[model samples]
Structure formats: structure tokens, C-alpha cells
Target chain A: MNILIKITYDGTNFHGFQLQPDERTVEGELNKGLAKTLNKEVKIFYAGRTDRGVHALGQYANFYSDTTIDIGNLPKVINFNLPEDVSVVDAKYVPEDFHARYDARLKKYRYVVHLSRYRNALLLNKAYEYPYKVDPDRMRKALSYLIGEHDFNSFMGKGAVVKDSIRTIDKIDVIEEGDFLYLDFVAKSFLKNMIRIVTGTALEIGRGQREIEYMKEALKMKKRKAAGPTAPACGLYLVDVKY
Target chain B: MNILIKITYDGTNFHGFQLQPDERTVEGELNKGLAKTLNKEVKIFYAGRTDRGVHALGQYANFYSDTTIDIGNLPKVINFNLPEDVSVVDAKYVPEDFHARYDARLKKYRYVVHLSRYRNALLLNKAYEYPYKVDPDRMRKALSYLIGEHDFNSFMGKGAVVKDSIRTIDKIDVIEEGDFLYLDFVAKSFLKNMIRIVTGTALEIGRGQREIEYMKEALKMKKRKAAGPTAPACGLYLVDVKY
Candidate 1:
């Protein structure tokens, strides 16, 4: 039987969501925590892999288990064994054929930027600290170019192995709350380092370092060097994965 | 001439606010950054030292320099040269006798707790992750005992070296916003781990683990064991320093 879990985690302590040899990763910790709870080694599957220092709110995972432990107690058991930064928000039985990754229809991500003059100690790792004064209207104009499907070859990082660079972006919205700015993107799929690159390019436009039309040119050029630098991973969050 | 800087730093990557050997500390980083900017050795005077993983909003520091660098560009120069996690919010000239630590009249601190069933991946290191449900009204009632003047030795953590534990708490407020709980306290002075201990005790009362009146007894006892466990350092932030 397959068990699905709706989870959230602070990814700062882990290398990323994927398992790596001799390194602490979210999946490795989750597997260890599940094994301790069920008294058996279990392999878990994730909907997607978040990079190191990237967090998730509604991350989905699945694992096969034949143990008799009550599903209701799974959250408590896993939370007790897991570190304070990782938590299983909910767990339930799923069909054996249910897939966490390939079956997903859409994914939503949010990147937060603290725009205030003062740096918040409490928000250090969770938010991108950009003290530069920004023009939101200019940023919004740059974001409009990213709302539809594009080749995205210009935004791809150097080490990405994926051959297909075409992806669709459902929507891209930039909203401000008090001193913080939130950039939300909904998409069926994203190229490697795509969101970070988009954010960096948009920030440059907002800072008056680049024009909004640069985004259109970058997409048409389909060259990696045409886009801005990739933003840091700390400010990004995997908000939700819909199936 | 001496330049006093009222700065804010996100301490996520720092050992603490104090200078320490063989560690990436806020003071050490600030000193190095200042030296790099001014092309001379610089020493900074801080209001107080913060623990590892702790944050500061209005931390004050002062440095002496003979260079005629424009004061108007100090923030830009220091910010451009400093690490991304550290920033200079404001800078000004101060009298020779104006001390960052000794001349401060009051300090304000805030501790944040996440009370929702769903953990916030972005706030993992910035706030306390409490899975149990909390009663805000009960927590507020318990905090009333901490207001006004009191001998807060009971709330001081073990290994605190202080000759006197008497302190005047100007105000203590418990605020609930969505699933987040914030405890704000203003005091003339605090003993070691005083705020954390108070927050832990208030959490105990809020969770129905203890009675509110127990706080009164704990204050009178002047014993560290009488209070609740010290809350983690990650959730605490020094918000302001008044002169």
C-alpha cells in the first residue's frame, strides 16, 4: 500500500529534498524518521526536488508500508523522531498507483524579498534581503513577459541536464505587503533555476539597472548569458503541488 | 572622529553578535568589513552581545576613523562591502562619551512562535515551531505577572552570572496574528536568558501545562529550576535600543 503525506520543512539544514550519499537530505531524514516510527526501512518518493536552502509548504511524498500503525498517529510518530525543522503535516492512505511527482498538474512557488532599510534578524534565512530601493511598477512590467509558455533556454543554469527547455507559466504575480515583496509563480513545469533567474532579472528591472523590454529580448535570444544572475535559493519556497 | 552606526543584522550565518576566534561572528564580520571599506583597522563598540542564531534589529555600534570619507555614502559603502546577511541601516556621528551599550536606557525584544498545524517552511529558523495548540488569552494573563518591577532571577537561566537580577519591565504584550504568536517585552535590563525563560513559562501556561498563578510563585522563588525550560535562541530578536 502507498501512503501519501502532505509535509513542510525548513531546508536550511539539509542539502536538498533528494537523497545524497553521506549527506543529510530531507528525504534521507524522512526515511530515517519513518523507519524509526514503523520499525522498518521504508523508501519514500517526493513530488519534486527542492534545491539546498529552499523550503516547502505543501510538499507531497509517498511511501510503501505494510505496518499496522494507525495513519492518524503517523504525524505524531514522525514528528517526534524528526528534527525540529522537518514536520509531516498530514498523512493518509493512497491508491497503490498514486504517484507523487509525475501525476502533479500544477505547482505554485513564492519568493519573498524584504525591501526595508533595516535587516531583520528573525527573517534572515527565510527572506531575500534586498535593501535597494525598487520600483514595483517596473518589476510588474518585467514579470508580465513571463506569464506564458517560453523556451526558457536563456534562464537555464549551466549545469542543468534537461534537454527540453520549453515550459508553460500559468501566472506570475508580484504583490507587496508592508515592507516585504512577494513574487508568486504558478506553472505546469519550470526549467532548472528558472524561477531564480526570472526573479533576478525582474529585480534588476525594478532597480532601474535594466529595462522591462530586456525580458522579451532575453526570451527571444534563448541564450543563457542574456539573462540576469540567478537569485539565491534561500528566498524561494515550494508553496503547493497540485495533482 | 568616531562614527556611530545603528545597524541591524540577520544572524543566521553568524556565531553570535560578539567577536569570537575561529568563527563567523557578527562583530568579527563587521570589523573585517569596516577594515576593508576604510583601508584601516577598525574597532566597534556594541550595546550587548547576542547568542548564536539570535537576531537584532536596532543593534548599535561605533567605530573610530581618521579618513575623510563622506558620511553620506557610509551606508552604501559598508553595505556594498559587507556580506549579504549583514547591513548598515543608519550611521551618524556621536559624542566621545556616547557609548552604545552603557548609555542605552531601554531595550525591546520580541519572540515569535508558530502555533498553526501547518509548519511554515520559511519561518523555520526564525520562529519557534510548536505543534501543540496554544491559548493566547491564558498566555496574556500569565504575562501580566512579569510586568512592572520584579526580581527575575527565577526566570534567568542557569550559569547566568549577575550580581543583581532586579529589572523593570515597562510592558509585556502577547499578540496573536493568524497562526503566529508574538511576545513583546520592554525592559530596562535583562538577566541572561531572561526573555527565553519567560516565554517558555508563558508557553507552558498557554498550553494548560501549568497555572498562571505559578508565575507569581516562580518570580518570588528566585530559583531557575522553578521556571519552565528556556526557549530556543532562534526565536528571540532584539528589536530596539533606546538611549
Candidate 2:
């Protein structure tokens, strides 16, 4: 039987989401947690691999197990065995053929920026600090150009070797709450460091370092150096993955 | 001229707020930043010292310098020279007699708790995570008993050696927003670990491990062991100091 699990974790303690042989990773920790709880070895497949120092709020994974454990108690037991920074929120039976990665329909990500002069210890890892005064109106205008389907090769990180860089952006929004500014994006899938690169370009525009027309040139250039610097990984979060 | 500067820092990167030999502290960094910007030596007096791993949002300090740098520009220049996690928010000229510590009126602190199954990587150094269900109503009831004047000897840490353990608590409030719970305390002064001890006791009451009556008993007992464990230092923040 296949089981679906919803999990959240602090990415700072692990190497990344993908499992590595000798290094600590989110997947390795999850497997260790499951093996302890189920008293058997388990192989799980995750929806996507997050980079080092990245976080997730509603990440999905699937595992195959011959024995049945009480689904309601899984969250409690997994949390009991896992470290303080990782937890299983929910567990449920899914279709035998269900795939966590292939079946995903859409994904949502949010990037947080703290615009205040003072730094917040609580937000140290969760938000990026942009000390310069940003023109929100100019950022909004630049964001308007990013909405819709486009070839995002210029925004892709050097490690991304995908053959096709075309992806549809469902929405792009800039919102300010108190001293925090959130940049929300929805897409079917993302290239490596795509969100961070987009954030960097937006910040450049907001700081009056670039113009909206530069985005068009960058997209057409299809070169990694044509865009702004990749924003820090601490400020990005995988908020949800729809399947 | 003498100036009082309101500063904020994310303490994860520093040893603490006090200056010590062979250690990276907030004061040491501040002095380095001021010296680089002002091109001379400077002395600063702080309202209080925070321990390692503790944070501050509104830490008060007074500095004396002979430079003609405008007070308004001090925050900008100091922040530009300082590290990303440390910042100067406000700088104002004050009388030479003004003292940051002795002349202070009130201080406010905030303890943040993330009560969720999943750990947030971004909030690892800023919030305490507890998987157990918390009864907010019960916590509120227990916190109310802590408001006003009382001898907080039981709530003080073992290292605290004060002539008097009595202090006045102006207000104590427990508020929940989204998945975060914050305990805000306003007081004229506090003994070491007083806030952490109070928070742990309140948490016990919320979890049904202790009753509200236990709070009264603990206060009367005036024994440190009678209270709950001291909450971790990472979750506490010096939020404001008003004079």
C-alpha cells in the first residue's frame, strides 16, 4: 500500500532535501524517522528537492509499506522520534499508483524581505534583509512584466541543465505587511534557483538599479549573468505543492 | 557630543551583547563599526547585557564622540559599516548626564513559541518549537497571576545573585497569531532567567502538567527547583526600552 505524508522541516540543519550517502539531508532524516516508527526500512519519494538552507511548509512525500500502522497516530509517533526541527503533520492512504512528484499540479513559493534598518533575530533565517530603500511602485511595475508564460533561461541557475526553460507563471504579487515584504509566485514548476534569480532582478528594479526593459533583454539573452544576483536562500520558502 | 543610539541585533552571530576579551560581541562589533565610520575611538554605555544566543529589537545605548556627523546620518552610516544582522535604528543627541541603564523607565521583552509539528528552518534561531498541544486559555490564566509586583526568586536562574529578588511586572500577556505564540512582559527590572522561568511554568500549566494554583505556591515557596525548566535563550528578545 502507498501512503502519503505531509511534512515540514527546518532546512538549516540538513544538507538539502535529497538524500546523500554520507551527509545529512532532509530525506535521510525522514527515512530514519520512518524506519524508527515503523520498525522497518522504508523508501520514500518526495515531490521536489529543495536546496540547502531552504524551507517548506506543505511538502508531500509517498512511501510503500507492507504493514499497516494507525494513520491517526503516525503524526504523533513520527514527531516523537524525529528531531525538534522536523515533523510529520499528517499521514493518509493514497492510491497505489499515486506519485508525489509527477502528480503535482501547481506549486507556490513565497520570498520574504525585511526592509527595516534594524534586524529581527526571529526573522534571521526566514527573511532576507534589504537595507536600501526600495521603490515599491517600481517593483510592482517590473513584476507586471514577469506575469504569464515565458522562457526563463536567463533566470535559471548554472546547475540547471533542463532542456526546456519555458514555464507558465500563474501569478506574481508583491505585498507588504508591517516591516516585511512578501513576494508570492505560482508556477507549474521551477528551474534551479529560478525564484531567487527573479527576486534579485525585482530587487534591482526596486532599487532603481535596473529598468523594466532590462528584464526583456535579460530574457532574450538567455545568459546566466544577464540577470541580477540570486537572492539569499534563507528568504525563500516552498509554501505549498498542489497535486 | 553625547548621543543615545537605539540599536537592534540578531544575536545568533554574536557571543552576546557585552564586551569580552577574545569574543565577538555586539558591543565589540558596534565599537568597530563606529570607529570605522567616525574615524576615531568611541565609548558606548548600554542599558543591559544580553546573554549568548539572546536577541534584541530595541536595545538602548549612549555614545560620546567629537565628530560632526549628523545624528540622523549615524544610523545609516553605522548600519552600512556593521554586519547584516546588526543595525542602528535611531540616533539622537542627548545631555551628557543621560544614562542608558540607571535612568531607564521600563523594558519590554517577548518570548516566541512555535507550537507546530513541523519545524520552520527560517525560525530555528528565533523561535522555540513545541509539538504538544497548548491550552492558551489556561496559559493566560496562569500568566495573569504573574502580573503586578511580586518576589520572583523562584523564577530567577541559579546564576543570578541579586540582593533583592523583588520586582514589579507592569504587564504580562500571551498572544497567539497564526502558528506563533508570543509572551510579552513589561517590567522595570528583571532577575536573570526570570522571563524564561515564568514562560516554562506557564507552558506547563497550558499542557495540564501544572495547575494555576501551583503558580501561587511556587511564588510563596521562593525555590528555583519548584518552577518549571528555564525556556531556551534563543526564543527570548529584548523588544523595547522606554524612558
Candidate 3:
């Protein structure tokens, strides 16, 4: 039977979501944990391939195994052995044809920024510390240019080999909660580091480092150098995946 | 001149607030950082001597230093040398008569509990994970029994050395936000682990593990053995100190 599982992790300790031969990764640990619980080898597929130090609140994955373990007990047994920074939030049996990666309809990403002089001790590595104050009005103006479907090649990550660079952004919002800025991006999918690159563009405009027109120019040029630098990985979180 | 400073810290890495020759402590790092920046030996008197793994959001301290370092630059210079988990929130010059401990009027502590089956990756050591659903109504009722002045010997930590066990509790509030519960305690002074012990008693009563009258019985008994266990240190935070 095919199984679907939701997970949450800190991601600071792991290399990334994908399995690596030497370094510890989220997929490696999940595979090891499921294999031990099922008493056999198991291969899993994930919806999002998050990068290193990128946290996740609602990451989804799937696996196949023939076992007698109850759906409720599967996560319990697996979580008991998983590392402290990672956990299986939920686990259940899906239809035989259900696929975690292919069936995903929407994925939500949240990038947090700390806008303060001294960094918050409790939020170290949990947010990207943007030293200067950012104007929300300016940031929103820059964000407006990136909304809707477009070829985001200028925002695509360097060295990411892909056939298509076109992707649709369903929604983009910039919210301020105290000294923290919550940048939410919802889309069917994203090119590698697309959120961070887009955020960097907005941040630059918000702080008067770059004009608002730069975003439109970058979108039109479709050149990597036309966009702002990619923001740090620590501030990014794969908040949810809709199937 | 005497310098007053407000600080915040994630206490998971330190032994405690007090200094120890062989162990790493918050006070030790502060002194080291201050001395290095001031170009001389330095000492500090803090408002709270929090236990190991106990966090602090607004801790107060004072020190005597005669240097060219301006009052405005004290926090900046000192904070730059301190460890990543500790930070100085503010610094200013205070009268020589001002004392951090003796002149303090109140101290507030906050204990956080994440009541869920799945642990939050970001709040590992920052919050207590209580799996069972706790009735807040019952907890509040039990908390009502703890308000006002009382000899909290029953709730005092083990190996506490003190001349008096009497302490006045200004207020006790239990607030629930989402899946997390915030237990706020305000008092003039506390016998070590008093908040944790009181919280443990309330938790037991809320969960139906112990009778509501157990709290009063423990207070009347005036013995540590009569009270519930002291909750873990990780969940407690020294929230604020007011003079």
C-alpha cells in the first residue's frame, strides 16, 4: 500500500531535503526510520526539495510498504527513532496511485525577516536579520510587479538546470508583525531559490537600495544579473503543500 | 560610573546565571565580554540568578566601570563580544545607589507549554511538550489557590539555602494562545524553582492526576515532599524585572 506522511523539521542540522551520500539529510533519515519500523527497505518521494537550513512546517512525502503497522502507530514508531529536530507530523495510507510529489497542487513558502538593530537571541538563524527598516509601501509596490504568471528566469537560482522557467504566483503578501516581516508566497511550484531572489529584490526596494522599477526590469530582461542577490537560506520555510 | 544594562538570552547552553569556575555561565560570559571591551576586570550584579536551561527575555544587571567607552556605546561594544545566544537589549548610566537586586520591586516569569503530540522544531528546548490535553479551566481554578502571600516552602526547590520562605505573589495568570499555554507569575522574590513547582501542581490538578485541594494541602504542610514535582527548567523564562 502507498502511504502519505506530513513532516516538520528545523533543517539547520540536515544538509537538505534530498538524500546525500555522506551528509545527513531529511530524506535519508526518513527512509532509515521507515525502513526500521517496517523491517524492510523503503523509498520515499517528497513534494518539495528544500535547501539546507530551510525549515518546513507542512512538508509532505510518500512511501510504499507491505506491513501490518497501524496508520496511527506508524508515525509513533517512526518518530520514536527520528532525530530530535525532525518529526513525522502525520501518517496515513493513501490510494495505490496517489503520489506525494506529482499530486501536490500548491505549495506555500514563508520567508521571515528581522528588522531591528540588535538581533533577537531567541530567533537566531530562524529569521533573516535585515538591519535597516523596510518600507512596506515600497516593498508592496515591488511585489506587485512579480504577481501573476511569468517566466522568472531572472529570479531562478544559478546552476539550476531546468527546461522551463515559467511559473505562476497565485498570491504574494508582505505583512509586518512587530519587528518581524512575514513574506508569504503561494504558487503551484517554484524554481530553486525563486522566493529568496524575489524577496531580495523587494528588500532592496523597501530600503531604498534599489528603485521599484528594478523588479519590472528584471522580470522583463529575464537575466540573472538583473535581479537582486539571493537572500539567506535560514529565513526560508516551506510552510505548506496542498494536494 | 555605574552602568545598568538589560539583556536577553537563550539559556540552553549555560550552566546558570551564576558564575562557576569550571562551567560556562551567563554571568561569566558577560563579565568576560565586558572586561575585554573595557580593558579591565569587570563584575556584574544581576536581578535574577536563573537556573540552568532557564531562558530570560528581560534580565537586568549593573556594573561599575571607569572608561572612555561612552554610555551609548557600552551595550554595542559589550554585545559584540558576547556569545550568540546572549544579547544586551539596552544600556545606560545609573546612580551609584541603584542596585539591581536589592532595589528591585518585582520580577516576572513566564513558563511556556506546547500542548500537542507533535513537537515544534523551533521550540525544542524553549517549551515543554505536554501530550495530554489539559483543561485550562481546571488549571485556572488551581492557579487561584496560589495568589497572594504564602510561605512557599512546599514549592521551593531542593537544596535551596535561604533565611525566609515567605514570598508575596502579586499575580498569577494562565493564558492559552493556539496550541501553547503561557503561565505568567509575578512576585517580589522567589525561592528557587518556585514557579516550576507551582506549575507542576496546577498541571496535575488540571489533568485530573491530583485533587485541587492538593495545592492548599502542600502550602499548609510547608514541606517540599508535600508539593508536586518541579517542572523541567527548559520551559521557564525570566521575563522581566522592574525596579
Best by lDDT: 3
- What is the C-alpha lDDT profile of model 3 across A1-243, one tens digit per residue? 999989989988989999999999999998888888888888888897999899998899988888888887777778887888888878888999898889999999999999976766777778997878889889998899888999999999988989999999999989999888999999999998999999998999999999989999999999889999999999999999998
Tens digit of per-residue lDDT, candidate 1, span B77-163 = 887777877778788888887888888899999998988655555565678988788888998888898889889989887776778
Q: Candidate 1: where are CA atoms >4 Å away?
A: A9-16, A19-25, A28-43, A79-87, A114-131, A149-153, A156-166, A220-226, B8-43, B51-53, B72-87, B116-125, B158-163, B221-226
Please tell me which model should have the higher DockQ, number 1 or number 2.
2
- Residue-by-residue lDDT tens digits, candidate 2, A2-66: 98988788776778799999998889888898899889989898889888888888788999986
Q: Where does candidate 3 chain A have its weakest 10-residue lDDT segment?
A: A116-125
DockQ of each: 0.27, 0.30, 0.61
Worst 10-residue stretch by lDDT in candidate 2 chain A?
A116-125
State which candidate has the highest DockQ.
Answer: 3
Cα-lDDT of candidate 1 = 0.85
Better of 1 and 2 by TM-score: 2
Distance from true position, residue B160, model 1, in Å?
4.7
Better of 1 and 3 by lDDT: 3
The docking quality of candidate 3, as DockQ, is 0.61
Tell me how far the alpha carbon of residue B88 in candidate 2 is from the true structure, in angstroms, after superposition: 3.7
